[model samples]
Target: MVLNLGLLLRIPVAIGFLFFTIKASGQQRYFAEKPSISFFSDGLVEDITAANQKVTSIFDALNGEIAFLMNVKDFQFANKLMQTHFNEKYMESETYPKSSFQGKVTGFNANSSGTQQVKAVGKLTIHGVTREIDVPGTIEVNGGKLKLKAKFLVKLEDYKIVVPQVVWDKIAQQVEVTLDFAYRPL
Candidate 1:
């Protein structure tokens, strides 16, 4: 009698647990479309005096594959040396071509409101090397959209990128990268 009642209660609880788990898993699999990401650089030394400003990288976020496309022609410099050296020696844009972050937003709430700080942990690939990085940023939901802003530092050595000795002083060992995203639900 007592044992039979316990078993009867346990069965329904187990079923309930399985139902919720399936629903949660389905929620995570849902995908967002066309999330945009952009990055800027301000580390050029000689170009500082020449009033050079460059905005690079406009990446698109798909379901799984994050595609980053940056036009080399978009970069501007005061002199030919800076342009040639940046593309060939420093960035090696021809060889590596692109940088990307493939990851998911954790604890994301589609109907969430106000300001929330979230941890975004994922693999960041740059210069042909991949590293696991956890970045903390605030997500603001207002007017039915998500606004995200985060700034983090990535070390050059972690990506096996060598800073030439001549301009070592000009570049910082760690590069500060910032991200600003405006996402709308699909």
Candidate 2:
């Protein structure tokens, strides 16, 4: 049996094409390292604040795609009783254990090596309710690393988070959420 020269010549070209295709389709991915998320509520009776450091995020610099995930129960409050109540009574964390956001980053320049103001336009899911939102944030790029910071207000009623009459004076109708994420290349 003899091998055809034409067929053998086409093998290298086919392999090269396959490699290029794979490389082109593989977008750059960045994973957050120790992301921080927090929220604060100022009410007539008292102020409440909580934070969650165990958050996960993935960012695609090339296409401006980003996503975030965190367990609802991970938020920690200064008052343990408040934390418990937040999870059970307010958030219903047992039924909706996680919160997430998925969307694209607008007004971002991937090639720029400085801080750029951007907006994440996407769906935010919390307490089993999803709503489309546009969140303004800043992305700082230095030495090939990325850090994202943003603060936005979330209306409890939008997500069906009910504040009982007994606690109306203690809980605010809206809460300010802040997040900071440092991402490393994946």
Candidate 3:
């Protein structure tokens, strides 16, 4: 009877250990969901400069999902007129609170070295319209951190965002967006 009890206890212990080992090994990726990403504009004459952008994504040693957020309030303007027009006419922040991108890393090879440019194909939803887009960007993995940088152009008309003729001269037709992020595995 004692032998049978000992065997039962050992069986449970072995099962528990295997379960934990599988769980630990299977969870190899980490993610952040509320990363801050932003865009900027310099009147209608000059190009915009976007900086200090943040992003939230899930990535392992292989691949993951990434989502971006754009705060309309973060945009700075040279004058109040441009700001008011953007808030009231363009973007319609009250109706559409945020813009987002959801996608996965395609053909990712984490072992790559130097400056490697990869194609990230994903769905971008802006102003409630979701569109599939392929963006070209560079991914550099150094130490244990991954750095990503990409620039893409978004058309206002595609998202049903209309720029009034009255303020047409004040806004650019196409907005240039830049995204830079540093990710660590969890």
Candidate 4:
């Protein structure tokens, strides 16, 4: 069979038009300027709190897609020994150096200029364990800037974080996690 010149010419034209349409849709991407995450655990013997400010995050305004990646060892604690234990024993940061979440935001409106309650449905991975979770949060858009805030609880058993028997009274079963991120257009 012989190739048709007219059909071959139309194929390239169709591909070009598809790319133009996608480009005209204006997919807005935002990058986090300073992302912060903190966790608190109240135990029988002691209360622990730690914060990490080196989290990286991205958001897509067009599709409501959001993602975050953070180093497990970046968390800072008031007690140095506790921090060491967190990285070595609980999180095993050497094996799983990074924790991440990838998901989409539900009920997000790009045109809204004020804070709106939204839910993120995604997979959260911690200590090498991945779980699908729905987290409630707020999105505030003001003066061309975007801010995200959320507070949620995490169960140690769910993430497979094993605590030593000796520190049973020092660690809690559930920990409260908080996130605050300010984003700028990319």
Candidate 5:
């Protein structure tokens, strides 16, 4: 008996399928059901701080793909008036209900232990505007979990978040944004 050309072709195809399956099955995924996003605006009148807990995000340990979803109205402030102004006046939450970020972590390796520095470069959508940015962040992997943290400054004008002249000085020209997420295996 001799091997046929058809059989040789099928052999390579089967091997390729097997390789992909094994590779995908061996790699793990991580996710954050409830991430935390905070923004602080230090103003001349008073300091304003707001936080949102209903942020959802996902991370692929093997591919380093990262995504985040945040509801604009979910942000809570100590002062209800401030919250109202933020949603209605600044963010227009009703018009733009959601904010998102889609980016990748370069050279991300979850198997490595300790802390690692990575830059998330992608589009960040806020206040009905999208801009490409590179955010520096750190990821700490211990045991079976990974904790990601990042902080950066965002200019309100960059996203077309206009601040009225009346309260211009009351609010900071730039806003400080912070992200904290704890991811578990998926």
Candidate 6:
């Protein structure tokens, strides 16, 4: 049932991502300082969440182009053990220290005020793996500043994150990811 649910959600998102990736290109760029990304996992045994506020991104307001960079080691969790395991075991932070996303926003307009619905299509790289994704989110422009937020799901196995058999039930197969990027014009 869970597998079916994921497939159902992924199809439309994939289609939208392809459309937006193509639509965003060649324009003036905007940049985000100290952007934030939060990762949440709800498992039968435990719910784990972590936030990284040291993210940096470059985005184009006119053409909808965007790119984000972050350090995996910078992600802070609720406890030290989880953080240690995530870095040394699951994420192999020593081996793969950085993660990034480079993409474009579809149908973006900086001049427009209020909140606008948009689709972001880009390549998200984590733990040395890069995958193409398209996700729906909202962008709010108030008095010239821009704010972008989105939430998406990622499968651990797809990124080659192998959990030990003993702790399989303690972890979730999918992780929910959220992003909050506040941009400043250059």
TM-scores for all predictions = 0.61, 0.85, 0.70, 0.85, 0.84, 0.83
Please count the clashing residue pairs in each candidate, in the order shown. 0, 0, 1, 0, 0, 1
For residues 1-186, write the lDDT of model 4, one tens digit per residue. Answer: 222222322344446335333443545667779899999999887799999998877677777778777899999999999899899999999998888888889888889899999999888999989999999999999988899999999999999999899987678989999989998876
Candidate 2 versus the native: TM-score? 0.85
lDDT of 1 by residue, 12-131 (tens): 444633543454342312212223343344465732212112222111122222212234334555666866776688668788765556555565555568888776777777777879
100, model 1: CA deviation in Å?
Answer: 1.0
State candidate 1's TM-score: 0.61
lDDT of 2 by residue, 3-77 (tens): 122232234444633543344354566777869999999978779999999886767777777777789999999
- Model 4 lDDT at residue 47: 90
lDDT for model 2, on a 0 to 1 scale? 0.82
Q: What is the lDDT of residue 24 in candidate 2?
A: 36
For candidate 4, what's the RMSD? 10.1
The lDDT of model 4 is: 0.82
Relative to the true structure, candidate 5 reaches a TM of 0.84
Model 6: lowest-lDDT 10 consecutive positions: 1-10
Q: Write the per-residue lDDT of candidate 6 for residues 24-94, one digit (tens) a residue.
A: 34434445654899999997878999999988665667657677777899999989899999899899998
TM-score, prediction 4: 0.85
Model 5: pairs clashing at backbone N, Cα or C within 3 Å: none
Candidate 2, residue 24: CA error in Å? 10
